[model samples]
Target: MWKMKPSIALSVHFTVLLLTLSSRGSSPAGKETFSWVTLPATANLTWTPCFDTFQCTKLALPLQYSDPEAGEAQIALIMSPSNYSSNDPNYLGSVLFNPGGPGGSGVSFVQELGPYFRAVIGPQYDLIGFDPRGIGQSTPVLSLFKSPPEALEFYSTYPQNVNESISSFGRFYAQANILGKLAVDRYPTIAESVSTAAVATDMLNIAKALGQDKVNYWGVSYGSILGATFAAMFPDNVGRFIIDGVFNSHQWYQGDWSSSLLDTDDALTAVYDACVEAGPSLCALHDKSSDLIRARVNKLIDSLHVAPLAVYDDSDPSNISFGVADYTVIVLQIFQMLYTPFASGQVIFEALAALEQGNASAIWQGSVTMANDVDLATCNFNASQPFVVGFLDISAPIACGDIIADEDRVRTSDEAKSDYQRMADASSTFATTWYPLSEGRCAQWPIKAKDAFNGSFTQNTSTPILLITNTHDPVTPMVGALNMSSGFTGSIVLQQNSTGHTSLSGFSTCTAEAIHAYFANGTLPAVGTLCQTDTRIFENPSNSSGYTGVTITPLKRSAEDYSLGEAARALAGSNFLAKSAGFFGRRW
Candidate 1:
């Protein structure tokens, strides 16, 4: 409903855009000075260029903003400039970005996707990414287990065996115990400061250090939550921000573990339905019908729950072994693969076909191969079982700090177990494994963040944010975006009638273009806007390009059947969600 002033119009040219701060005078004139801090904008800061194409910088922020003068910590950042320099009329300032995993290295994100971002969003604004406190490259680098072997041991000890039945609670409980003890030992006081609020403040500080008056952000998945927090805290400092693959802050911090995961199950179901449509000639496990293919996959899951299948293990001199714990891990892998159906559809079909033909070793071997993003040796699955210690070491604390805990309500292990059963009954496909995994890690997380905000989320920012989400995202659902929109008054939503973890890429050329337009010129798509998904799950390039509204079988119950409080309780009973191999089919 609101538009940028004519003075700040895209075509308007200015000889100079001065952005400065002083402890004495009011904010400087122009659209570039932030007067929020009482001191000169440039405080303790340093920047250096590294890797030939990027600038690396560190800001010494107070360890605890509440006690700023008490202690300080270093926050690391990496910057990739636009094609146009500040001296050029084409320069559009900086758009700070966060790539989802609350613990995901922002430095790595910029270094890895700098060129792609510049191409998609336009090479006018500099792309800046900063590692939040307690995360990668930042000081107090939340290292859970120092070495690769130690990290392996932490995962190996939990849920001890790969062949253990899914019904067995011993493995999950064991996992919770180790996670809880390890988090306390590793992070201690520092973990308390890792909440989303703290990270939001870090973003503001980074913007000020970079000499930007307002904040410009692009965050995906969990990063969406961080973006929202920033907009809320620095409403007047709002720039153009996009929260893609929107995550529901309420569901994330509170509970309703089942609700958040419901869409993932649907996404998985979509993959099966697509495979069936492709037919056995094209799909390896495509039997006679789609229903039959789904039934077959469910049967495999059941069988694994009954007994772990034998698989090759290079760690064993005999070269053969089976651990029950690996079954859930492998299933999780399958879930991740399902995210990019068009890209990895055939590979998934082949993997399922191998399983149908009784080749269990090949499946685990496949997982090892796909998850090799690193040196391959880094996440060596040659051991007795496989596991990955991902961004969770930092993600857990930040997430735990944000949500209101249900621990006191549960009171005992038996109550927690009962609650888990209730969740499984509601939707076993999404809940059974994921609910337990996420809860296990969080329940054991020791500290409650003193700075985390769980109060009213309303805010009147200078400019409203643009929220986007795929119709069927695997991790953060469409419902999340819908719900999150209500909290931010005046915010607009763009529903990409597609399916995936995020709304960009080949999935929807339309969605990508819409995002590009907003960044290039601050124009929001009209209310109730829905962009058609140009690429179908298994559709080839020559096929018709448009949204197919092909409804994957909906969840049995209406979402309204459960309340947020109920969902929160469900989440409270669980701990850490299982970690994924960084990328699909690539384990580094």
Candidate 2:
């Protein structure tokens, strides 16, 4: 759930990452652009007309693969059908996507950005998005709260997340965790059923039902974990897989998060460097050096941690709606900014500047939502996105359930403290607020997977999957992408030299063209290939950079390359993810 403000209630506006298109247009080919519309439903609701040009349906897969009689879990699905016939020699088949929540909804992802993807990957493949079992629209959703309102109240008033006090941890550790047992106690079977491996199996089954022999896929963030799991579990069935903003699957499988922070500090520093580059006119926190800016920000954080700045409505002395701009809110906002820096990087800088002079508007997502009059009803969440509009506590179990349950998995409050310290060591600006998600989240996780895949990551799949990422991913580091690539022989890592969460987190023509090529043909980007983004942050919105793609092993640029770069330049200075509620997600 990304959009953050000091307030307890949160909501998300779905501008989830896909490339920032020049604008929706015709296919790269000469055909008219495919548009979807709201349509009436069929009585059976099986591959029926839905949301206009799309189709919606459900599949009942076994809750427990080992015990078919145990029962079945219904999987909600949606698809944007391709115009090209599968019989067309160049036509690729069905490509399925998972937006990395371990708990995120694939259905919602497709619903929001299916047309954009149709433009991105061309119209040959039938693009599909599904809510993994136990997630949005999927049956038996692993909800801890009875209703959205109750969940919103609990999250809005969450005491543990507000301060860095030991009591905060003790209270949160004691109370928030009961939901784990509550989950198992209530829906024992379904709670135990939503493992990644089981979902992988469901994907394979989904492809089979769709009459495709092998599954083509695109996954981001935690979706990387799901993609790698599928590749490892069903190697022969792999086809044109693309995993971006890679999560080190090894670390994920081990129930550890320490390794993911290697690039976090670097990412924060980059934002400061960019601010200095932009100068005082554009970047409010600009300084002679990045270090100076960091120091100023750090000093602010330290003072706030000691004594939070209380903001009030000047006319109304009693108004605490903006609450206190403290270390918790400050650092947590940094965590939010890290997801998509171009959309949010300057925000923290300006917020810090504003806070120094007594204003807290820029730093608060809740207040912004309020000021913008975004109906809180639109804030609903699925597993992949943490946009706080609606309810979905299943993220805890989806995460906790994956780790084969062990006594070592759950940490004591003291151990939790150490974990926090360790994460803090990794990211001084973070760890305080982020620890709960990366590691602390598992402290109360209860279930272990019975249908877990104990397979090795190194699988000689039918085709070498493609891996892409931003150089400075706030959550999943680039090294993790390299680490995961080592397992899948011949897998190429195409990086967009930019700071953000994933490939989609930034606009890179070189990277996009590389993706198009990979899907158009099985060609992979040459080793040591690096791409430049078509846009720059904190620049004159009118002055766009015409950066195409770059590769270390240089060759003459083609005419097509220039066109893509021109398209990307059209996107310069656009804050695409300013409201990206979630895709592939914030946590993963």
Candidate 3:
């Protein structure tokens, strides 16, 4: 959501990088000047130091690309510099990044983990992240309720989850329909402008502002979908792009995300195996065999399904408060923890073990949240619930608006049930709890995108992109990378032999080397290349955590030699997933 402004041209030659647009015709014989950062004078793109170590900038882009006159929207951008000036021989260029929440905030992402990402990709190019249109820090925020009280009222009375009980499925389905209608009713203008295609164009504009014709990018999960869309829409503009944790564009644009979780169950199997290898001392859920452990865990969850556990604080004479730890609430935490198993194995197992012993504090404390359950009795009426931002405001529109919606979508209870069952059949592990990520997300979506691309993803870019995927991603699996790579001829699939969401979720020296080599000099690994991650999951560290009671290891390595696994653990405090915090934990 930005309006383009007229700016100076950039020469792609290594000799003279930055140039003026007026002198384009009289430039030196062989140099080709490209029109970059053509922003209006009112919206000049300028950088300033922010967050102590990073450079921050905001660009005004056309609210609607198709109609430049449709006012403008502000895009918040943050960049971690490569520490090399343009004249320095070490300065390559800039790598534009999208952490992938079709609705994720780049400003917050860069603020939190820019150093880690810049270190991983190499120090020659600047790493940049942005909050997509109508997202965090960006103008025209998309939200259903303006304040905390409204959201609290809705969530408090809403179906806790679709899987809370047999009847909850129907209530949750109706609630989603109501939410879609409410969102569109609240923000139709944003709903029309927020799509993957629009974000792709925004990336091109960002690349131009950075004085580069080709965009150097690293996108994860939903970000991968954004990268693929960029390559397909503007093939010649592609520059050393990497789509890690591949989300099949074919599956996404079709309004069908059922196929993406094909490897979630397999990821769980790996987690269980690693637990057995770690022994009972390190892993709380250890068993002689994976099957035995699975049965044990399933039995606990089954019991919760029949009778939910209630946690009550009756210490105060007059005030007794309670919170319920049900099947859906605990499973949602399990499904999210599975995203980074190396870091969450003990967190999950420990909570489960505590629950098995008839204590719900561990799991309930980590999972189901209350605004002020204990203090509700004495709670001031004027005081509101803690305002926690949710991403569904943007994710719903991107997922629902991008697709073609008919009169017969997720409007009815039967349609929602059928869609959910389809997802469960594809991957039974966390389908019920994780259903909000994709399936039933478009229930009664009221608005349609002004511009949507449900076409082929085939592209022949000037520079080929590198596609990376974990062997067993909880959401976007290996098949997605293969399917995405098929359209881009000459593109190579770099497989990281790791269990988690993406290559960053685990530590792999080989994968790091390949990433470094690729960005440093457009180097491509051999066809059928497989990199093994060095992460040792389910291993207890020296110190236990104050929060989860699991042993926690602190990561403080320099960017030059950082471990992706350790970095991931450090980043657990922030929601690294680009889409909804529903799966990844936090909004940013």
Write down the lDDT of every candidate, Cα atoms only: 0.58, 0.65, 0.66
Best by lDDT: 3
Cα RMSDs of all predictions? 14.1, 7.7, 11.0
* Clash count, one per candidate: 35, 14, 13
Worst 10 residues of 1 by lDDT: 10-19
lDDT of 1 by residue, 438-553 (tens): 54445545567767765555777787889998777766778888888888878899987765566641245566667778899888889989887654455432112221221112
Q: Give one digit per residue, the lDDT tens place, for model 2 in 1-588.
A: 122232211212112221212111112234344321222222233576655466777787888897888787777778888887778886788889876655656775665556556656766788899878876566665655554454545554444252466577776676547756666676767777878899999999998887788999999878898999999999999999999889888877777787677788998888888888888877878889999998988887788778877654445557434456666667766665676666445545666777676565445544322422223234333334222232225556666677754566667778777766776778755655556655676776667766776789988999998998778877788999999999999899988899877777666878878877887787899988999986655553211221112101112332224454443432322333332333111111
Candidate 3 lDDT by residue in tens digits, 1-588: 110011101100000110111121122235342211221222656876554466666788888888787668778777888878977999888887766656656565565567667666777988887878876556655666554455555555455457766677776677777777786677788778888888888888987877778888888778888889888899988989898889888877767877767888888888889888888877888899999988988888889889989876666769654578778666766766666666555666777777888876556653424422211223322232222235455677887887766555445667667777888887765777656546566766767777676556888888988999888888888999999999997899999888877776676778877887899899999999998866567666312442241222223544666564444444432324412233211131
- Each prediction's TM-score versus the true structure: 0.77, 0.82, 0.84
Ten-residue stretch with the least lDDT total in model 3: 6-15
Instruction: Tell how far residue 124 is off in model 3, in angstroms.
Output: 0.9
TM-score of 2: 0.82
Candidate 2 stretches greater than 4 Å from native: 1-45, 148-153, 156-163, 313-321, 365-392, 405-409, 541-588
Quote the lDDT for 123 in model 3: 77
